[model samples]
Target: MEPQLLHGVADSVATVVIHHPAKRNAMTAGMWRALPPLLDVLAADPGVRALVLTGEGGTFCAGADISSLQGSPDEAQRLAQRAEEALAAFPKPTLAAVRGHCVGGGAQLAAACDLRFAEEGALFGVTPAKLGLVYPAAATRRLVTLVGPATAKYLLFSGELIDTPRALRTGLVDEVLPEGELGKRVAEFTRVLVSRSQLTQAAAKEFADGRTDRDAHWADQARGSGDPAEGVTAFLQRRGPRFTWTVPGPGSA
Candidate 1:
């Protein structure tokens, strides 16, 4: 199939599938360009409480379609940076459901998500060093934040692939599932995410990302929201709380 990003939403979850199976889902320039706008649409949808990014098949992504970077490396790098930033800025929870290889730009995309779940035997790498490309500062900092300075340096300096165990140990992936169980775990976990209060999730996302100024704003919002009351009532009644809050606006948090 032609390289593209396939999108879908169901049960409050939006799934973006990177499809370039001809090259193990390597992203093309066009695919990189498409991500921000697609994410905008999903973010604006009230039905979308969370999102999952994954590859089309066994391989998560092999990196950029090298041809996309052939003529103008700067342009390709800029596209990737923008796409990565968009994912990081998404208002709701975002998860990267990964399998097989997730290297270079693929690793960047996965790192952008709030969480990453990989299958056993998956291989991951940060490979700009191999291409003699300077990784963007923001992406580098984000990677460092996820895996710590030492582990991040190891990956960036060597451009060598690491297995799922190493990725998990370094905190690069949140969970490592067994083979075919990745999809099941992802679906099960996202359902739990959707069942909870989006208000709490949105606020927590911003806070976890290091926004210290929003504490007051979130406090006021919590006071005004019914989620807290419902949560209490549900606990007393022994039932799931019916959370009614959605994000107040798009492109927030």
Candidate 2:
């Protein structure tokens, strides 16, 4: 099949699949540009309460298509950083369900998500050093935040692959599943994510990402939102809460 990003929404979860298995799912220049707008559409859809990013077939993305970088590595970096920022800023819960290799730009995309789950034996790397390209500054900061300065420097400087065990220990990946179990766990976790309160998740996501000025905004959101009340009622009644607050699409209040 042709290389592309395939996406679908089911049961309030939007799944974005990276397809390019011929080159181990490496993304081309066009795929880099396609990601942000696709994420926007999904983020804007009220039906899409959470998102999962993954690769097709066995392997996750190996990296950028090296051939695409022959023309201009700078342009590739630009598009990639843009895509990464978009994923990081996505208001709802986002998870990277990874298998096989998640290297270079693929690792950047995965790190942008709120959480990452890798299958055992999956390998990961941040590989700008291999191409002699300076990784984007914001991307570097994000990496540092995820894995701390020492671990981040190790990946950024060495450009060597780390096994899933080390990645998990360093907080690069949130969970490492045994082979054949990654998909099941991602589905189960994302179902729980969509069942929760968007008000709480969105606020917590922003705060966790270091946007502290939004406390007042979220406080107002909670006041207007019925989720808090519903949560209490559900606990008192011993039933699951049907949260009513929905995240507005980009640019909407």
Candidate 3:
């Protein structure tokens, strides 16, 4: 079967499955290219309050399909960069439901999500060191932001696989579940998340996202954006805000 992104929805959560389990759900360049448009669909769909990214056949994702690494290195890097941008900037909340191996590009993909829920058996690593490949700076930044400089350095430098417990301790996985219960647990958690207000979530995501960069003008820009006004008004009235703001589309606008 052709490697494909399978889409399924459950109780307002959109699940994007990477379906190439024979290779441990390893992602190809085409699969990387496919993520952005799928994310766009999920973001625009009012019914999809949260998104789940997982892989088929127990394994979350092994990494890039190195078997197909015959392309121009520059082209591959460019495409991977674009895909990473889409995943990082996707509006609304995203959860990575992981199991088995999550290494290299697979780990990068999961790190791009807002939260990661992994089975106790899952493994995570940044394996560029092992493969003699350079990890992209943006992906490195995301990993650093999640686990801090010291932990990020250890993972990137060693290229060793860490178990689920170590991953949680390092803030790689937000939550861990027992083997068979991972799917059910992820579903329950996602449902609870979607029940909350999107406006609050969006603002929280924005604020938290900008926190890493320490943008000097973020305060004034945020206040002038009108989002805070709607937020305050909705809170005072005990009603939901009609959040009219939209993030910039993929690629330079």
- Report lDDT per candidate: 0.94, 0.92, 0.83
Weakest 10 consecutive residues, lDDT, candidate 3?
Answer: 244-253
Compose the digit string of candidate 2's lDDT tens values, residues 1-253.
8889999999999999999989999998889989999999998899999999999988988989878655666777888899999999898999999999999999999999999999999999999888899989898999999999999999999999999999999999999999999999999999899989999999999899998798889999999998999999999999999999999767776
Query: What lDDT tens digits, residue by residue, belong to model 1 across residues 1-253?
Result: 7899999999999999999998999999999999999999999999999999999989999999977666678889999999999999999999999999999999999999999999999999999999889999999999999999999999999999999999999999999999999999999999999999998999999998989998899998888889999999999999999989888666354
The C-alpha local distance difference test score for the whole of candidate 1 amounts to 0.94
Ranking by lDDT: 1, 2, 3
- The TM-score that candidate 1 achieves is 0.97
Compute the lDDT of residue 171 as modeled in candidate 1: 100
In terms of lDDT, model 3 sits at 0.83
- Per residue, candidate 3 scores C-alpha lDDT tens digits across 1-253 of 8897899887888999999978899888889889888888777777778889999978999988877656776677667678777988877888999999998888988999999999998999898788777889989999999999998999999999999999999899999999899999988888778766564576678677774553444454455567778878999999876555443343522
Clashing pairs in 3: none
Report the number of clashing residue pairs per model.
Answer: 0, 0, 0
Candidate 1 stretches greater than 4 Å from native: 251-253
lDDT winner between 1 and 3, please give it: 1
Ranking by TM-score: 2, 1, 3
Top candidate (lDDT): 1
